[model samples]
Target chain A: MEKIKELDLPSDHISEFGDLVKQMHDVDVNMCYQCRKCTSGCPVAEYMDYSPTQIIHAVRLGLKDMVLSSNTYWLCLACGTCTTRCPQETGLLEVMDALATIAESKGIRSNAPEIAKFYETGLSNMRFFGKLYDLGIAGMYKLKTGKLTQDMGMGIKMMRKGKLELLPTFQNQGEMRRIFKKVQEVEKKARGATDK
Target chain B: MKYAYYNSCSLRSTGREYDKSLRAIFKKLDIELVEPKNWICCGSTLAHNVSRLLSLVLPLQNLAEIQKEGLDAVVVPCTACYSRFKTAQYEIAENPEMAAQVEEVIESRFEKKVKVIHPLEVLSSEPVISRLPELVEKDLSGLKVVSYYGCLLLRPPKIMEFDICEYPQTMDKILSAVGIPTLDWSHKTECCGGSLSITRPEIVRKLSRDLLEDAKAVGAEAISVPCTFCHLNLDVRQEEIEREHNVSYRLPILYFTELMALAMGVSEKDLLLKMHFVDTDSVLQKVVAR
Candidate 1:
């Protein structure tokens, strides 16, 4: 109850966000019913600024700005817990994914910058190397965040333990490059219709 | 049983012990796992989190490659890769438009027909567990473990659909067959902070502290997990967690396959159990007591 107040939902009506989510995935955003089961079952709900149910409600009411700017979806573990436990099978996790996609393209400032940085570094390295390069991604993230010595002790030990490989880890980079390009080409066409 | 093994990128690199132990155990059990030609990453969480289309195409590329080799069932050891493959399976089945787009993007057809089976599903089946006497060289009678099946493997029951989402017991069944007693614990399927282990260590420390504390509360000498991420989070990060939480927890987080390999009399030196950051000396002392 108190948390919902923090949303400061817009006074005027703009329920299009609800309609928009319904357009994105198979889940019906309107049928949320405010059961609160999704929020209760969420693994990272405590860390979230707004609960999953609250986000769903905000989306249902078309509080796009409020929902997009919030950190709830950013913190979601994608553990599939809330979706599994929902009586109506609301699929909040699926909705969260769709919401995150929309949030990024709209230039919304991420409430969780480290997560965005991690994704940026990871995707860049993954595309370049044709697979995940553990050391490369970690090194990039540290530089971006300027947390150079963050987890340094464990990082040093893992390097010795062979947990961190200090090289480009794959071949066939040309094909991976193609796949990355092809995804962007297709994503623009697919989402450009539903979004814009 | 034969399978086109898709070890994913994690198992190929950071999770070598998992791959090594799985191969060693299956070799003794007479199960064959063949790798299809030209396999690639499943795009991991970055795909689904970034573009739903990449998540669909990347896994489908691997699935199509396996199908081309005529293998109908794929053995996915890494749960993150397995979940992406399963999510792709879900998307391709319901959305024809997305399906056509993915097929066109990859320049190949995804028949949408391959079965994505996890190793736990295969190993825990009655047929495999029932035949353990012949394969067992050292029964794990003295070992006590808590089976941890973190998120991706079994949740959102409609998708993962393999084990119980909240309270999974497949690992318990599989481990018990080798004579190790798996105790009941509430955090069996709890989230271990997922990829946030990299993006947000604070979240992982709290979540894993609960997991380690729960496992200890249940009298587990060691913890067993199937996912590489879970093992890394629990095993690699335990000391940090212990120091932060101001507690003493020296739990050996073992991959389920490594335990299976151990029971088959594979030596500790060969399995590299000692390489674990949170010393497995306790588990080693227990399991090696012929």
Candidate 2:
């Protein structure tokens, strides 16, 4: 069994952010006995460079770079199989989510460019419209990531089948703007806290 | 009771039959489905996986509109939408602080009091189930249907609470009510690799093929489910599954509502079997023949 390492951080970075991580540790991260049950059950591990167990280990060690840049961070589908199967009742998925939040804050880009592009477009679409328009978001993602030509045939077929509507069906633009403003406010607060 | 019906993305596109059948069934049961004005996608699996906060907020905004209409509950026909809505509801109901944060994020006073019900729960209620036999003009005496209750409908059952997490009997009970003999099968609550159907086709193919083969092992001629995403995965992906596995298995997958509509004397054409990639004609013929 691999010995668990305690998180060591520089004095400057030790504040509410560290406290936030501790609050997330309410899920009994210490209960993980290196069973590797999470790794075995993870569907994405086959394609991921690091398994779920490894991601947990990295987070436990506070190896920010290793945890953030790993494929497992972006690849987890949060199926809850790991959490369900954990003998020690470790909320593995929740821990991964908190880690992912940390990684996002750090602006650690994913090796999978498509995944990041998808998130950006999705967030932008939600911010602008207060809802997701799949066709529009997909188009925007493709344009931004230069993957437009990859699945042009599928897009053509979808359009032909009336699956891809050209225009978004927005009921109230005012409501959307209000929601976007609120999100911006929340993000601003979090950013301020991080800066302090 | 009236509900703001969210047909969701899949039902609007690939699984439109589910929408048609659900509306018809709800109409007969005296349940009024008030379609929301200019509704958008529920963010489904994509939004939830990418950003949890954003996903919760998007669905909460939609629910806010439903609340504004004075409806207590929103009837979601698509399983993914039902699961996501139910999940958001649970999260909001449990974590008041997170709810407040989400409420702050959306700039709306969300009371965290709305209930999300899947169409199956509404359709398979005691009153609805009791009225099934009387409503069935055509007896599905011979259709060997396997009720596939995909992962969303069951798991994380703490949120869904509609049926048994492992072996749900709602669909089977409804099928039996309409005189359709359901196959006693395992793998009912198995994962279909869902949205991963797009992101990871090979994995989905292997998982879906194994599920199809398991259903066939139990002598199921067709499979029925309450989820549009599962329907798309099991039915449309049959071609890809067959290609990848190097085997031919053309088992038609029907939305549970489609079968209910059929038993209630709805015409096959009206049920939109034509929209399905897998032809259900052979299975329907067996039922007619019996």
Candidate 3:
């Protein structure tokens, strides 16, 4: 998906963010009661600029700018730990995902650019190959991030063990391209509705 | 028992050993595994992060194909792929709007009832578990390992519906039945820095180190896992984690299927134990003839 310009701030940014999350993910942020259960169970809570509970609270209070600006969602592992623990069944993973897609839609640069690049590289690989080319994705990620020598040793060892594929595999590439196009169309229509 | 096998991408590459051992064990169990024609990737974490619709559509499309082929169930060995399939079904069942949107994207109706069985669930099933003890041709009770469920198999309890999320017993149950003893330990459902193993190796090192330390403290000789990313982070990255942290954890990460294959008298060479980054010889040597 191509990056687009950020939309102008709406009168009620809180409702805008909450409504979009509710509409898109079918999750209501209003259900979170500030119990901090999500924050407590999160594996990467220590690394997040704003913890999962705080992000949920921010969403409730309509602190979209603050929530989107933080590195919290980008660092989220999406392991579903908090989602499982929440008594409210708030679907924390979907909330984090909404924040991520929203950040990308607004063209707000992620604080964790490498993580963002990793997702972008992976999605592009899937769109083109119909299957994930692990070797290709790793090679491209290393080249793009300039971490060429970071895991060079491990890469060689894996290659020798026949664990890493030397070539890309394909399956129904034509249908995959069409599916990707349809997804883009759906997302674009959703974006237009939210912007209005 | 017949079912379609969904190897996903990892089994074809980094986790090929898992594929080898699983096929080996299933052959011994007398279960038929059929690979559906032209099965595509499940889109894994990458799809959901980009567009929620794509994630559901990808796996839903695969399910549609399996259903069309007259198969009602599929065996998904990779936990990551299994989670995606489960999540897709959960989303569709929970939200009709999503179901319609997914139907529109894939140009097909998803058979939400199609069974997505992980190897852990398959092995622990009544038919298989009951026959495990007699199937053993080699003794493996000497090898002690902790069962690491990682995140996908048991998390988001509502969606997965496999085992208890926090204190899962499925892996341990399967291991014990085959005369393989598993140590009780924490970090069963903990996240292993998953896909971040690539983008954020630092975090993976820290998280994986904690898990390895916990297993060592519990006296586990090795770690067994069901997910590809978990195996890659815990097994392949063991050396890097050791060097970066100034410690050595020679714990070999093993697939539970490999252990079963060993018990069933599948040769060590056939199990692909040598392909692991950590030396699995120490654990392999512990197996005695029954």
Candidate 4:
């Protein structure tokens, strides 16, 4: 996904953001009463730039800049802790995901760029190779994060055990690239409908 | 009865130990697991974080293959993969349009019928473990184990549709079937900093330290887990966690299936206990004597 160009502000930004999420898969943000049940149960809330509850609150108010730029977007483990406890079953993981796409396409940098780098590297690896490569993803990620040599020892150990394949293992890369292309086309068609 | 195995990327590679032990234990119990001809990654956190459609379509395509093979269920051992599978089913089932969109991307019909079962759900099934008593050759009678469910097994309760989101007991029961006395610990369903073990090790170090410390306090000689990421963080990185935190924790993390494989007299060669970074020799000495 490329950076979405800055557009003229919509009359109701919160509704626009909420509508975008709801349109994606009918996410019912209306049921979220800001009870903070999601926040209290989140494992990484303490480390997050915005609490899960706060992120939702930001969403309710349409504070996309704050929500998108926060570290909480990147730190979520998608462990389903909050989603399990949610009385309305809002699926906060999906919310974080929706916010992340908006953040990424709009060229909003994550508060946790290294975390963002890991995801970017991982997704790129999957798109290019048809599957996640443990060694390859780590190499690209270290280069992106400039944290090379951080886990060199452990990498060597895994390599010795033949866990890290030097080359891509899955043979479905051609099909995978096709699928990736088709999805991008679909997303483009979806976005093309928007006035942005 | 037989089911298709979605032995994910990690399971096929880095988590090969888990793959061996899971297949070994299931074989011992007379259950068969068939693999779909060409399954792919679950897209994990990466796909979902990138594109919603990519996340749903990846798992849907895998399920489509399993369904075409006539398997109604696919046993997924990796917790991360399981989470994506369950989430895909949950979201797609709730929205027919989204499911159709995902089907378009993969160019296949996804009926969304595959049940994503984890190892605990399978091995802890009454019919399966009921046969364990007669099958135990080595009898891991006196070993103290703490079953670590980690985060994904039981969270997001509605979507997962099994076990208590917090304080799950399935892992405990699976360990019991293998003859180890499983402890009830407060940290059973806690986060092990999961995939962030790569993005941020210090976070994993702190979280894993707490889990190891709790297991130690409860007199657990080993920590048994079903997730590859959990095993990687808890076992392979324990030494670093211990050193960084100024503590000594000599805990050996075992894939739950490895423990079961041990009790069923599967050889150390099959379990590959030596592959673990933490010394598993001490823990296995007990199982060997049994």
| Decreasing lDDT order of the candidates | 3, 1, 4, 2
lDDT of 4 by residue, A1-196 (tens): 1233344544444556677777765675656877898888777788887788777766656666666778887888877788878888887877888877777677676578888778888988987877888888999999888998998998898788766787777647777788788988987876777646
- Give the least accurate 10-residue stretch of model 3 chain A, judged by summed lDDT: A1-10
Candidate 3, position A48, lDDT: 85
Query: What lDDT does model 3 reach?
Result: 0.87
Q: Comparing 2 and 4 by lDDT, which wins?
A: 4
- What is the lDDT of every predicted structure here? 0.84, 0.71, 0.87, 0.81
* Model 4 ranges off by over 4 Å: A1-14, A193-196, B288-290
Report DockQ per prediction, comma-separated. 0.66, 0.30, 0.68, 0.61
lDDT of 2 by residue, B5-58 (tens): 886656766667888988887787788988776455566766654455655776
Task: Report the lDDT tens digits of candidate 1 across residue range B1-290.
Answer: 89999977787667888998999988887899998767877889887777778879989988888999998999999999989888898888889988988887789886548999999988987788898766777767788899999999997678888777877889898888877889999998888987898888999999999999999998998999999899889998999998897899899999999988888788877886755898887776776544
| iRMSD, per candidate, in listed order | 1.3, 3.4, 1.1, 1.4
Native contacts, share recovered per candidate: 0.59, 0.14, 0.73, 0.68
lDDT of 1 by residue, A55-92 (tens): 99888777777898899878888999888888887889
Superposed model 1: Cα runs more than 4 Å off: A1-14, A191-196, B288-290
| Fnat value of model 4 | 0.68
State the C-alpha RMSD over the true interface residues for candidate 4, after superposing those residues: 1.4
Q: Which candidate would rank higher by DockQ, 3 or 4?
A: 3
Candidate 4 lDDT score relative to the true structure: 0.81
